[model samples]
Target chain A: MTALSAAAERLRIRSGAYAGQTAGLARGHVQANLAILPADWAGDFLRFCQANPKPCPLLAVSEVGDPALPTLGTGIDIRTDVPRYRVYRDGVLTEEPTDIRDLWQGDFVSFLIGCSFSFEEALLADGVPVRHIAMNRNVPMYETNIDCVPAGRFAGKMVVSMRPMAPRDAIRAIQITSRFPSVHGAPVHFGDPAAIGIRDITKPEHGEAVPVEPGEVPVFWACGVTPQVAIRTARPPIAITHSPGTMLITDLLNTHLSVL
Target chain B: MTALSAAAERLRIRSGAYAGQTAGLARGHVQANLAILPADWAGDFLRFCQANPKPCPLLAVSEVGDPALPTLGTGIDIRTDVPRYRVYRDGVLTEEPTDIRDLWQGDFVSFLIGCSFSFEEALLADGVPVRHIAMNRNVPMYETNIDCVPAGRFAGKMVVSMRPMAPRDAIRAIQITSRFPSVHGAPVHFGDPAAIGIRDITKPEHGEAVPVEPGEVPVFWACGVTPQVAIRTARPPIAITHSPGTMLITDLLNTHLSVL
Candidate 1:
């Protein structure tokens, strides 16, 4: 097991002592996708998550104007605990900061979303091969013609992460991943990219494309990046999020996320 | 909404009052895939199902030599409850009989396997369109190159039932089906059949092929027919099964099978 205390790891991140991606850090804890918005946009975004659960699976919502996320982890100061934060103004990224203390607003609300990292760990534990991880690359992600259930202005086509596995492994992966409903659950699609309006399989919208072998089929899961894409399209006056790959490590055990 | 009384329906089946398929009979009640074997081959088949859950999800096992399946329904006699039964001798079907009372042996062991009907109801309830159901045909099934976990003399490639759906509905279907693991949990594959060694999309080894529309991908689920194929390969001296499309209607509610 990876030997790292989740709380101590958060402290390091908060102190600006750690600024790298949180992918392999705090191993067993539930790492969340962070999305901070002004109190004005919080209600609509929350409803959006409720409507499109597979993509924007909401785990926790911070109290309005609160900086500390008590439910996710102890000593988690949302403003400083994330290794990297992206600040957006009118939907355009204006700054990338290691800490957000100077920009903390009294009317801001933070939303923690379920991330795929936890489910990937479950798959690996079950001896399923994660192609991208083995090749040391980010998972291949595609923007699909599949539309998310709309809620007010928060609307956009769904984005999905793809992994290729043999038929047998794909079946087992479906069963295993189904246990973690909060983390995108089972795959959204598998096989032909064109079937989902993905014109180019090798050319993904975000992340690097991994090799899909002769007998392997590409399995796509509803991605957390979907909410980010939607947020960008909605053009919120101000928004904050952890830079891609930088996540908030929570105290909740990954196993605790399994419904069954 | 199907208006058929359980006992009256069984009486109809036994008296040749109903000659049609039992697909939607006794809605809300559990319908079982029947597999009757002589005492000698029963143990091995039991072990096979325990080893390979996806293709052979066993819902009930009867006492050796007993034709009565009490757990499934009240006063249910396996030999007469089903509309029709196929009698196999030395692994080949020798007769299709309406009643197996005369053939019932004291050494026979009956196994009730979970059928996709349970989960299909779930998917439809959740607003996922099932192509075959909409088209009024049997689900398209294919023999995949994927092998089932072998046990004793029971071993063969898995059989899968296919449905065509858009990516969004496919994801919802996965979540709905996952709750009924006993009825083949989630899909084994979706998209290209060639990846699973199914060369032709228009032709299937069993069941009718439904049209896959431009934007819809073919989703394949582990089929109950898989065990029947395995059992045939074993060539047991004496075996009996409900005729294809003619299932044993039981009192067990479909909701009772949901794991989540």
Candidate 2:
């Protein structure tokens, strides 16, 4: 889009002019992990997000059967704003679509969960290097032994995203990321891979692993993938999520997400 | 004193009835690192402390030739309130005294500095175990390679206090301590000691080393001793400080120091 405004970017996505990861796009504005479920499952899913905020920090919830998330952005249409979407049937990936306009159900409820991209922008601005961004790879993520508090049928172990940093930078990362509790807050763990039940540091469960340097430590933050793990366990009849790295553009500024 | 009120404790020290470490005595109050210098050096020292806040966060400063630090508490006598004192003459330790009343000078200026004891209380309240407290030893202190911004005559590498914690606790400690910027907020360095120019983790320049467990990483905070190092290097003709572990307790609640 010429303007590159969040709404402009969304309009481009809606028109099928762009269908790619939203990580670095729409810089300074908030990018959200999209989750859509039928009206019947919305309450329990909302509860899951609230109960496990480190993994699923809720930013906005749309009115039942309405796509507009007025609180997050203007004239937003969840079914078409995100560049890419993963539609699951009975918790199994059934289709990948650029726009979900045709698939949208009148009873669908949309949830906008906080994304790490917001805080990654904050970290980069503070001169902290994000390894995945520097490497041009998806942040390596692993399923952790830490369990999420159950809400109805939505419950599972946590999944965490990894970033390798020198101890000094990691300390700085902790301080900077803590300002945005909505975007995973401070790191959950660091150092030993096996301590958090990851069998191998190089073999992450999701995304590619970048080398943690000789003196660098691996810092882990709770990942939005955690909700996907819970959804897999719950085995809902229909579930829709933004494909990994593909996020919904919103009007909220990254700085606005900072709780402090 | 049978009562643990900060005022009562300060009264005992003022009366020369107590002359011991202030740790755990005034559990909920803010404790300060005491520094006294000739009036001529006070402005430079204040500037040094302001420039290197992480190492020398200034909480309160008494007017020149004044023994009263009324801002810190009711009638805080800099010359006598601390349990024990170290008097240095031309950079050399000349006396260790319980009361400095006889030595008080009309041209002396008193500086009250933020102490780690305040954040340690915050950490313990958050259910984080402090190893030095558990082991009944002093927290290990190390000299770092990171240089302080030189101000007038005061300049030196920062001295750091080490507390070994599992990654989780260290992260939580960073978040909790960050709220108290006046008390050397967050850690300056963590993980490898060598990275910060600390040659040996087991050997510390000041204080006793406690055991660091297998999964634990040594977390380092900028120490109050940093100013002591600078002061020693500056070699002012007449200087005084509270002996290590002996502090000036104040009426401010530790909770009030938290920014959030």
Query: Which one is best on DockQ?
Result: 2
Against the native complex, each candidate's DockQ, computed on alpha carbons, is: 0.43, 0.82
Question: Which residue pairs of candidate 2 clash?
Answer: none
CAPRI accuracy category, model 2: high
True-structure lDDT of candidate 2? 0.90
Spell out the clash pairs found in candidate 1. none
TM-score of 2: 0.94
Tell me, per candidate, how large a share of the native contacts it keeps.
Answer: 0.56, 0.97
| Candidate 1 structure quality by residue, lDDT tens digits, B148-224 | 88888888999999999886687678778878988888888877788788999899988898999987878899888
lDDT of 2 by residue, A1-260 (tens): 22258888889988899999888887899989988999999899999999999999999888888989999888888888888899888889899998888888989999889989999999999999999999899999999899999999899999999999988799889989999999899999999989989999999999899999998999999999898888888889999999999898888899988877
Model 2 has fnat of 0.97
Expressed as tens digits, the lDDT of each residue in A52-88 for candidate 1 is 9998999999999999888887768999989999898
